[model samples]
Target: MIWNTLQLALREIRRNLLRSFLTILGIVIGVAAVITMVTLGNGATKSISDQVSSLGSNLLMVRPGQRMGPGGSAGAPMFKIADVQAIAAQVSGVKAVAPETRKSASVVVGSRNWSTVATGGTRDYFTAAGWTLSSGRIFTEAEERGGKAVCVIGSTIQRELFGGGDPLGEMMRVADFSCQVIGVLASKGQSAFGSDQDDVVIMPIRTVQRRLTGNQDVRTILVSADDGVSTDTVKARVEKLLRERRKIGENEDDNFNVLDTKQIAQALSSTTRVMTTLLGAVAAVSLLVGGIGIMNIMLVSVTERTREIGIRLAIGALEHEVLLQFLIEAVVLSSLGGLVGVALATGASLGLSSLMNIPYLFNPGINVMSFGISALIGVVFGFFPARRAARLDPIDALRHE
Candidate 1:
């Protein structure tokens, strides 16, 4: 009996292939969109977390002005070098502290010249930033103390200036000073905010102060907390120490703002997930439309096959068999659409991720969920039409048809 019903359902679908395809088109589009959006969003969130973690998981950036975001600042007073020393000495939970100062400087090496962001900081910056050199060695303590004209360049700078050749011990003119490239930093790719991370040059703090910016004011102080120490604890201690040292009154707001990189990464990841959920929800509406199409087409199919249904009923066919036949047909149509949708979505996501430079994460859970939902849509929408056809009077249906 079940075999008969299945065969009849397949025959009906084959008889009107165009209509059947059109009916399932909405399901295909809905499943594809939901999967694609969710997959891409998850990848983006992961990429952001990685980039932030690369800056050191327990990192804190203390800036003189209230920063709106990472490396961002409104107009505010610059921190002096003494403040950096004070934070290192007074903050107990800190592993290391580095004074950061930066300016745009044009670098010239022979005929190849490039303009990039040049930064200055102590050798501790490497540890605090989780940076590992691709070649050569870090700045020596003597070099930093004596303000030697030695610098480290990122991978992008190396590619642009040296064309993949060895950059170690090569001399590059940075602004007014001719500096030797002591090291090349490993590729960091791009930041979560879409800025090039490997397009920078690093030098000793005093070197930048003396030649690049010609100032003693520090832009920011990069701090790394000791392992197992909470950044909030460090942040609180640094805030208190700075307030006392800067001599702000009890009633006044803090002049300096401390930022935790982990907190920023979490906030951004949470936001991306929320947006992904919202987009997935919006795309899910098409599934309902697909369900409605299934319902409508099933009703039409019942009407068209009234004569066939009457004949079956007269031949001792059970009402349940008639209902199951139509229901199964609807489910099969939707399930087929879902399978096709998954394939299309996979291709689209991979292509889009490559084009956008985001990672492609294959989430089996979402794929299974979409497929299951598509099948459920079939059952929910197909049942009404199936019941209606099963309850139709054979004599009336046969007479009318």
Candidate 2:
């Protein structure tokens, strides 16, 4: 009986093709919009979490500051080289510690000049930061102490200055001081915030302080904890050591800040998840609008076919059959619109992600759930109109014009 009703429902839909198309328009747009927004949000969140995770799950950053802010060291006070040595010698579970100073200077390769940031640190700087040298080698301890004029270029700087040629053994002048390019770092690519991480040069700590910035105090410290060691424990130990060394009174706050990137990543990930859910809820409103459109059209259809209903009932048609016919029509309409919406959403999401430089990844579970929910909306909204058609009085329907 349901199969027969479906055939009749489809035939009726075919008779009013134009009206049917107009009625389904709302459903199509609503479903497509929801899908596109959700897909983009999910992809962006996943990409961010992955990048953060890659930086190391057990790394701690010590910045110089009286009070910590979101910008990390930008709000902090200047850290000292003595502090770095203290953490390295006294702190347990600390594998390696690197003190660093950053200064922006103009770099000259021959007559071509470009302004770029230069970091001054020891050979442990790359190891502590989870970076590797792609070519040549990092500065040795002798070079660091003697303030040798040697430098290493990051991948971005190498490409801009040397093109495809080897940068090793080349001479580059930074801040009126010429240095030999001894190494080039491997590419780390752009970060989640779209900033290129591989766009600077590195030099020995002594060289930068004496030759470039002329400051003895370091800016920040990068610390990597040993395997199986807790980051919290390391932070506590380091803070105690720094306080004792600096001779700060126990009552007053210490002029230093210790941050764990692992903690920051977890907090950020939780915040992003909440944001994604909120955006999805906003998009879901369009689905409700689509359902309302389906209900409105179904009601009009029942009114227009009242005489047909009356004739069928008078001939011997059952009320349940009438209900089934109308219900099937509603489901078919929504289901067809849903399939088309899914396809459109997929294409639009991919295109927008590429243009915006965001990652484009389709989640199968989300897609399937959205399609099923669309079909369910059709049934819930269509039930009222279909039931009204089924309960119509044959005598009154026949008497109407």
Candidate 3:
């Protein structure tokens, strides 16, 4: 009996194919928009996490400032190499501690020159910052100790300066001094903030301080805690030691700030998720609109089929059977819309993710849930129209025009 009713519902839908398509258009658009927004949001969150992780595992950045951002550390004292050494020696669960300073300069090789940031630090800076070489070797122990005029170039610098030629054993003039290229760093693409991570040149800290900046001050300290160690614990210990070393009074706020990369990743991810939810909610408003559309069309359908309904009643067809047939028709229309919407969402997500340079994360659960909601919408909105058709008087309906 249910199968027969469903067949009748399908026949009626097929008879008005154009109207049925138009009726479910709203559902299709709503489902597509909601799924696409959510999928892209998840991709963005994943991209943020990956970029932050590229910085280092269990990483903490210590800067001599009460806060972060431009000029936030102004008037604060700069750290010395001794501070980096102290952290390495005194702090437990530490994998490596690197003292670093940076300067922007034009690096000239022969007649070709490119502007890039020059970072100065010991070999441990590579370990602490998760930098690895694509070719050549890191600074030799003697080169580091003597502050030799040697440099390691990032992939961007290598491409710009050498133009696919081997940069190792070549002399590159950095600012006023010439340094021999000893290594090329593997590409790290871009940072989370959209800065090119590969656009850099690294040298011994002493070299940068003596030649470029003309100072012995370290601008930042990067600490990499050992695996299985809590970064928060390490951060606390490092903070306590720095407070003692910098001679901060118990009542006075410390002049330095420690930033955990893990915490940064988590905060950024959480914010993205909140935005995703908000966008999904806004998109979901269309579903209600679609449901209303279904209801309006179903009511119109009942009015048009009044005479046919009366004939069914005269032929001894049950009232519930009439209701069931109309209800099934509504459900089938909405369900078809849901299926088409899912397909459209998947294609849009892939294209958008590629254009935005983020990952495509297909969530089956969301697709399934969206389809279920669309079907449920059909049941709720179709009921009123179906009930109206079932309650009509056969004699009066047959007598009407």
Candidate 4:
């Protein structure tokens, strides 16, 4: 009985191949879109998390900035270099602190000149930043104390300025001061915020302060805490110490900002997860539309094949057999579409990621879910039409059509 029903379903589909294909196209496109979008979103989130983790899991940045007012204007004074020293000395669980000074300077190596960002900091900055030297060595305590004109070129600068030749021991003029490149830092690629990580150069903190900014203060500080210390605890202690040292009243807000990258990453992940769910919900509407299209086609198919259904009913076929036949046909059509959709989506995702320079991650779980949902849609939307065909009155259906 099942074999007979299967044969009939195949014959009907073969006779209306064009109509069957058109009916399946809706589901094919919908399933493909959902899988592709979700995979891409997941890959992006994973990339962001990896980048954040790369900056060391226990790092914090202290910057000189007041809380912005409604108009985005600074409401308090900036933090000074004294705050950095105070944090390093007073805060418990703190491993190291490096005060930073930044400047945009033109680097001149004989006739070759390139404009790049310069960061001035202590030797601790290298360790706190998870940086390693590819050649030469770090600045000594004497070099930093004497404010020697020495600099470390990043990998990008090393490639751009020095080419194949060794940049170490080579002197390059930054702005008005001539500094020797003592070290070449390993490449860090790009940051999560899309900044070129290797484009800048590093120098002794005093050099940038005295030579470039002409200020005795540092703009920012990078802190590394002990492995077992909690970030919030250290942040609170540092805040209290700074407030007392700076003579801030209890009612006044903080002048400096202490930011933990791990906390920022958690917040960003939460926000992106919400966005992914919302987007997935919106995309699911297309699948619903596809289901509706399948139902409409099935109903039309029942009406067009009324005589055939009547003939089958007059024979040895039972009502349940008629229903199962139509149900099987719908499942076959939708399952085929789902398989094709998966293939197309995989190719499209790879192509799009390559073009956009985004990471491509093929998620098996999402693909299986899509395929299962497609099959469910087929069963749900195909039921009504199958019932109508099964309940057909043999005499009336045969006479009318």
The numbered model that scores best in lDDT is 3
The sequence of per-residue lDDT tens digits that candidate 3 reaches over residues 197-230 is 9999999999999999999999999999999999
In model 4, the clashing pairs are none
Candidate 1 residue lDDT tens string, 1-401? 77888898888789899998998898899889889999998988888888888777699988886555554555566799899999898889899999999999899888999999999989998888777899998899999999999999999999999998999999999888899999999888888778998998999999999987889989889999999999999999999998898888999887778989988899989999999999899889977887898899889988988888898889977899989988989988899889888998999999999997889999999999999999999899999999988998999878865
Return the clash pairs for model 1, or none: none
Shift of residue 191 alpha carbon in model 4, Å: 1.4
Per-residue accuracy of model 4 over 1-27 as CA lDDT, tens digit each: 778777877887888999989988888
- Could you estimate the TM-score for every candidate? 0.94, 0.91, 0.96, 0.91
Clashing pairs in 3: none
In model 1, the runs with Cα more than 4 Å from the true position are 1-4, 69-75
lDDT for each of the candidates? 0.89, 0.83, 0.93, 0.83
lDDT of 2: 0.83
How many clashes does each candidate structure show, in the order listed? Answer: 0, 4, 0, 0
Q: List the residue pairs that clash in candidate 2.
A: 64-76, 64-77, 65-76, 65-77
Model 1: how far is 193 from its true place, Å?
0.5
Among all candidates shown, the one with the greatest TM-score: 3
Off by over 4 Å in 3: none
| 10 residues in a row with least lDDT, candidate 4 | 67-76
